[model samples]
Target: MLLLFLLVLFTQNYFSHGDLIADTCKKTEYPRICVSTLRSNPDSKTADVKGLVRIILKAALGKANTILNQANDLLKKTKDRLVRQSLNVCVSVYEEALDEIPEASVNVGTNNFEANIEASATIDIADDCEESFSNSPFTADNNAVKQLAVVAVDIIASLG
Candidate 1:
């Protein structure tokens, strides 16, 4: 009985953290991003699902801030009226997404599905930003913004 107990304890301790993270990541739409992001963060190394959700939310918020900053900076540099207009739209879209991130983060803690819906809407913001630059000379910028938004969407999907 003593040996059996010791073996069980060792196995549980050995597998619990890593296994928990991997299992949770598997549920996310972007498993690679989910696993890589969680594994890279020291705080998430031993986190449960709730903890992982918070970590992911934090990361998404940071990414949204980055997108917002990038849009603002681009708006300042470009002299083209059309490009500036498109970038302005991007700034507004990212701002809304940034606001949604914190609200979603809070609601996610309580298992609120509405938070997931709000978070998912962030993708539409990115799409609109990209569409604003359609047939314009801002293809690279559009792609970059869209990529960041995709990451946010993936993070939100994981929350659901």
Candidate 2:
């Protein structure tokens, strides 16, 4: 009987159901902790944090729209050197960021990984040049290009 019990215990250890009880217990406890931690009082600073975050997000969106409108207006109205230079700077920074994506490749063989390793290096220098610098706000001469640049500017502004 002892030997049978030992065998059962050993088999139980090997035939794991992946600790579902423990996993569920951990997941269940977190939501209770979250609910308990929420501010009980409306006047408390902790309660006000969410309100503040909303306000900040709204303000940021407003500012981005204003700036984008101003940029469009300026680009349309003037051929001023300073405005052109600032647009150029924006384009330069965008292009630099694009240049930094890693290019990679992979090789697979039918026999084994060893055979794959022996095979020639298949190069894949990703020419993402169009995607990378495709977001320049100053490149919006045509309607489609202007739309693309506006979208990029909106994306960048939202990150702030």
Cα TM-score per model: 0.75, 0.26
Output the lDDT of residue 98, model 2: 26
* Candidate maximizing TM-score: 1
Q: Candidate 2: minimum summed lDDT over ten consecutive residues — where?
A: 100-109
lDDT of 2 by residue, 1-160 (tens): 9999999987786334223222222332232222222222232222232222222223223333443454556557769676655544434432332221111001111222321222111101111212233453423222222222222222222223
lDDT, candidate 2, equals: 0.30
For lDDT, the strongest prediction is 1
Residue pairs with clashing backbones, model 2? none
Model 1 lDDT per residue over 1-160, tens place: 9999999988887578888777776765566777787788898866666677667767766766776788788877989898888888878987887787677667765755766766666667667777887564444544443443354445445555
List, in order, the clash count of every candidate structure. Answer: 0, 0
Report model 2's TM-score to 2 decimal places: 0.26
Q: What are the lDDT figures for the candidates, one per model?
A: 0.68, 0.30
